[model samples]
Target: MSSTLYAAGRAARQSGDLQGLIDAVPYARFLGIRSAAPESSALLQLPFREGLVGNPALPAIHGGVTAAFMENAALLCLLLRLDVLRMPKSVDFAIDYLRSGRPLTLYADAEISRVGSRVAHVSVRCWQDQVQQPIALARGHFLLEPAPESA
Candidate 1:
């Protein structure tokens, strides 16, 4: 599975196919995750679906779903931006729920703070209508496997 994903990642990177990369991940497809503007930025988007509602009364998105979306944003950013050959593994993730996620399309952007030899630190913010009013924020570390040098 990892090898397949690695090959897909390499293919996507070589062709600059952001949607293809998202399609390579089953879970991302299940969540309706897509690139907001792959040609410009690493912004990720999740279309609102009835199944995504956690609170029917309040019509709010599930917390777990929101977290997973943000995590995916970070992971996608790493895959799109870095020279990684193997899949990036989450080391630690911390999220702050600023507000309940409304039953609307969610947008997320991940910024890589630093990249060490083995780990990369990333921060992500999820919002609905307004970017200034974020619904959730997260910071995480991912274990990276750099591509081996050519002889």
Candidate 2:
């Protein structure tokens, strides 16, 4: 609950400006994902754009694409938490595909579960326009390294 929003310029050294986020948004958009504002607590939303559709011959979005969105959301959460400061690395991630992400903007919300001294645990829930019904869930372990002692 001690989350704080960082403006475009003030965004954690990691999350860049809207334009930058927008430019970098490709990182998400490429995966069909985009992070929300109010950095304190954010969500990643991805539209079911035509180009991103896989096997349009089929009714469901590609599982790989959806999973990519989940990864972006979880990682961005860690970036926001560090005030864009520390650069943490993902040690491992576990994802559960609950349902198909269809006909809507897929989203992922990162929840801080625990912050140990060396690792931070984050939980992400992905839903397609509806928070109640989620398409997937993910949990990640990020390894944190302290900043080098400055002179």
What value of lDDT does candidate 1 attain over all alpha carbons? 0.87
Q: What is the C-alpha RMSD of each candidate to the true structure, in Å?
A: 1.8, 5.5
For model 2, residues 12-76, the per-residue Cα lDDT tens digits are 44444332343343465456455465434566677767655666666677888777777777766
RMSD, model 2, all Cα superposed? 5.5
The CA lDDT of each predicted structure is: 0.87, 0.65
Cα displacement (angstroms), candidate 2, residue 72, comes to 1.0
Local accuracy of candidate 1 as per-residue lDDT tens digits, 1-151: 6666666677667776677777777888889998787563678899999999999999899999999999999988888778777679999999999999998999999999999999999999999999999999999999999876750
Off by more than 4 A, model 2 = 1-26, 83-86, 148-151
Per TM-score, the best of the predicted structures is: 1
Winner by lDDT: 1
**Model 1 ranges with Cα > 4 A deviation:** 11-15
Candidate 2 has its poorest 10 consecutive residues by lDDT at 1-10
What's the CA error at residue 3 for candidate 1, in Å? 4.2
